[model samples]
Target: MRRPSTSILFIYGLAITLLAFIYRDPYSLLLISIPNAVAGIYLGYRRAKLIVVLLLLSIWGTFLNAYFLANHGQVVAVLGPLVIREGAVRATAQIGLRLLAIAGAALIFIGGAEPEQIIRDLEAELRLPKTITFSLAYALRLIPLLRRDYSEIMFCRRQRGYRRIAYLPGDIKTLLLPLLSIAYQRAIWAGITVELRGFRKRRPRYRRPRIGLVEALLLSWLALQVVLPIMAGWTM
Candidate 1:
């Protein structure tokens, strides 16, 4: 299967994130989470197994949330005479749907697109500024680097005889400034390397990636995001 463009993924991510916060109804929560789960499984380009596991966890969490809400009697439906089951049985199904949709969208976007490809697509296809594209690329790399650095810093602290070993949150508080400083230094060196290699002064270029069915479908999805709310009178 062909990969989705960056703009499509961005739109999908933004849309679900938007919906997650927009509606108060449990059904809306389901709507948002389902896509997140699917996207997590299908759209991820890195650590496929890990992504799938995380997606499943998200799906599970949504189900649990719905189940919790149902127990409170907040989620209820009346069918012609007989009422539907009061709690988890109903809420689980509702929330499950949303989680599936969310993961699916995430999988579609992130699963196939590589970091460089995504940045390029964003810059060229989406017409984002080159600076922004570069910044995003840098930021994306930093996510993993930050994690690694945090580990190293903690190790160094332990090796140097610091007795207090903190958990993730505590480690974060102690390590953030130093980690950030290291990251900044690395970024500056990377920037200098790019400049030395003449990347900064390179002439602009573009690719004519075929606007095929995938692109068409993605455009439709993007358009739907704008049109659906207007037609349905739903703010999301």
Candidate 2:
């Protein structure tokens, strides 16, 4: 299947995530997520195992936090068709499913997006200013570099006989502080390089994207997902 435009995918993803937040209905959220999940899988996304693990963990954590940890000493209330414990369970399930739906939408949109293409689309279609587009593109491109830098920092720390202590705050201070400093330095260097090259004065050439029937169909499907739920008064 031909993929939809990156911009359309991004907008649709955002819409779905916002819908999930608004509805907060576990059953409806799961149903709505099916198309996005299928689209992601069709686009060659192979993170089902990871997504399943995360979903299970999120459900467990959310359930514990909502029902036991957070509501430990609170009085249970009797709502229509549900008591306080049941309400909490319902809320936990809704939140878990909503999160999974959001993740699925992200996988569908972001997995197929290229930083350069997104920048181009934002600049041309959305009329974003060049500075904003460039900055956004640069930030996206920095993710892998940041990961590599973190790994290198950890290795250096290990080589210097640094051992992780039991205290979480201490560990964060030792590890995260250096990583943040490195990230700051890298950002500054990138700014300096851009300035030196006078990149801001030049207009970037963007590849013009072609939208076809496939894109229209995908967009229509996403629109229906949002509209049908609203029409059916499914927003919980």
Candidate 3:
């Protein structure tokens, strides 16, 4: 049998969120947050990591600020706000750690997913409405399509009496209009293609696949994702 795909991992991760809704616990919420951020990193790369780290920092910072507000009672004197105070620093540290944990979790799942697999699973396995599924599939393709169009637009602008100079609005001006126009055209074309491809067709009945060993294991993990957060929150 073929190995379980990246889409499955993402689904597993998403299951965690549903679990969070079912059980509101700060501790479990924090636990779930870590995996979500890590999943983002895993899906992308350095960019994902950067995003997750920033997020963790932000959360930890908030906690630090809370601590300071409760304990230090804000710094105010003849100087009028002496460099934010120690609590501020501590808050920042807390936020940083939370963000790091989130980033780590995102990285784990993102590394395991493939864009193609994700699209296919969303389209077929998930039994999402056809129209929405197709829209998402097209959206996944948009990044590359936009990049290619942008490159072509830039090249054309450069040829048409537009020289790119450092630190100048002229560089952006040369390409922006054409890029916008191309993007609009592409979006229209994609919409038409999807419409013609019967994406809006009536929902077709699908035969569910029997849960295999791997799927069963993944499902179990997902179930745990739901249970753990609430349990953590309750216990904490």
Candidate 4:
């Protein structure tokens, strides 16, 4: 199937995230996310893997924090109905499912989208300011370069017999400063290159995007997912 345009995907992703926030019920959130999760798996398994990892970490962290706050530093409560800790569990589960929904939608929409294409669509279809669009595009383009640089840095460190320690603080102390410096240098170089190229004066002409049946159907489905729940009083 032909993927929807970046603009439509972006909008749909935002709508899905908004729905996740609006609906507090964990089951409702999970139900809404199922379609997006299926789409993400079908459309972009490689892209979805990173998101899945992040989602797991986020859920664990949120659950721990919520549990601590609910228990007020007490031990874990016994598993029983009508307990105060039950509220914490419910809250944490709801948050985790909500995050899952948002991440799944992002994987479905942005996993296959090119930064250049999104920039073009924003500039052309949304009539966004060129400066904003170009700046965002530049940052997005730098992500892969930064990832490669990080790998190189790690390789160099290993070559110098600098093995990573088990402690998180030690790891951060060893890695963070060097990575920050590299990022700063790259940013400076990118700024200079853009300035020298007269980036401000260059006007990029974008072709208006055509929306077809596929896009229309996708949008309709997303609309139903969000709107029907509220209309039926399933979500507040």
Candidate 5:
């Protein structure tokens, strides 16, 4: 299937997130989570796995705090200072699932487009200023480039007799200065390159993304999901 445009993908993400807040029950939240999971896997299963891992950690933190310090209602367990209660467990599950839905939905937007395309969408569709858009563009490009640079730095370190710990990010302090210098140099050149490529010149008018059957089907699912929570009397 052809990928939906960046703006549409962003709407899909935003809708999923807002619905997460609206559906407070464990089952409703679980229902909402399906869309994000499906979308994440659709984007890329490898990245989806990473998103799931990160969200699981977030859910675990939610579980621990709710089960112990924030315990409420009928007591379920008593482990000295750490108490477990029926209400807390229920509340925790609802909260954890909501986090999964919200966080994963956001990835649909983050991985949806190239930095230049995102900048174009923000400027054309959202009517943002060029200054704001270009800065965002640079930051977006910076993250992935830094990841590549980090691996290269680690490789060079390995050749220079540094421990394997250097490869594992345990030697991050040694990386900061080099990464900073590299970033400063890149920023200067990137700015120069962009201008030389007609940064100040007006390009042709931006084209809006075509909305079609894919959009209709996705929006239909969202509408149905929204109605279910209301029909079932779920609320945040």
Candidate 6:
């Protein structure tokens, strides 16, 4: 089925990612991440792939760190320069699970949600400050414009044989002034657009969405993820 509410999803995702750090046991971290991973897969397969890739990288990094840098406790294996320790394996699970939980939590917010929609929802429902709402709304719009600008600038740089950073963002180091000039012009236009709209202190009110049974069940699941782990003394 579809997501019930993005606002609830945002809060739930943030809560899990933040609270994940409180648990010490790897199994507890794994437990908390499962529901998020499951929900993400069900709701958005495409976006879920990104999270899966990130989790894979984290797992790889954790094991690499364990194999190379982790040098405590009893030796489990030896392979020339590589020394595998029992503690290193434990550390790998701890760190990898933490990353897994964090990545899984991300799915709840970004997996199936649009940036503009999220901003609008928060602005209408949460009543965020005008400055914050306006900035976020405009920032999202600005990204594609900036990318186009960047492509044009990079093209010009290549014509000039500017090999400073080789297609990386650092290539902008010398091009900063021109980019700033473009940005300044864009800001001026954005301000004019806002003023024309008569954006003011009075914010239009939005009716709150009624939560259905599915959302209520999701809320309960979110609570249980933390509560049961804490009850089991799996906290750091």
lDDT of 4 at 119: 73
> For residues 59-108, could you state the per-residue lDDT of candidate 2 as single tens digits?
66676568654443344675685345655666676787787677678667
Clash-forming residue pairs, model 2: none
Tens digit of lDDT per residue, candidate 1, span 155-194? 8878876544443344435655687789889999988887
Task: Give lDDT per model, in order.
Answer: 0.60, 0.67, 0.55, 0.70, 0.70, 0.69
Give candidate 3's TM-score.
0.51
Worst 10 residues of 6 by lDDT: 164-173
In terms of lDDT, model 3 sits at: 0.55
Report lDDT (Cα) of residue 68, candidate 6.
Answer: 70
Ranking the candidates on lDDT from highest down gives 4, 5, 6, 2, 1, 3
Q: Which ten residues in a row have the lowest lDDT in candidate 1?
A: 45-54
lDDT accuracy of residue 223 in candidate 1:
60
Error of 6 at 129 (Å): 5.2
What is the per-residue lDDT of model 6 for residues 1-236, given as tens digits with 9 covering 90 to 100? 66556566666777888767877777687897666667666655553453564366567667877767775899888999777888788888777777767777766566555666766666676666767757755754665566567668767887898973433334535455566789889999888888788786447567574467766877798888878877878754
Off by over 4 Å in 4: 72-84, 135-188, 202-209
User: For model 6, what is the C-alpha lDDT against the true structure?
Assistant: 0.69
Q: lDDT tens string, model 3, 1-236?
A: 54555456656655554554443344655665555555556555642333443354356446545545733535532235444545554454444444444444445444554556555565566676766655545654665666567567657766776764312344544555676787789889878886797766746554444457766777786677666655655642
TM-score of model 2 relative to the true fold?
Answer: 0.63
Estimate candidate 6's RMSD in Å: 6.7
Error of 4 at 37 (Å): 2.6
Instruction: For candidate 4, give the lDDT of residue 15.
Output: 86
Number of the top-ranking candidate, with TM-score as the measure: 4
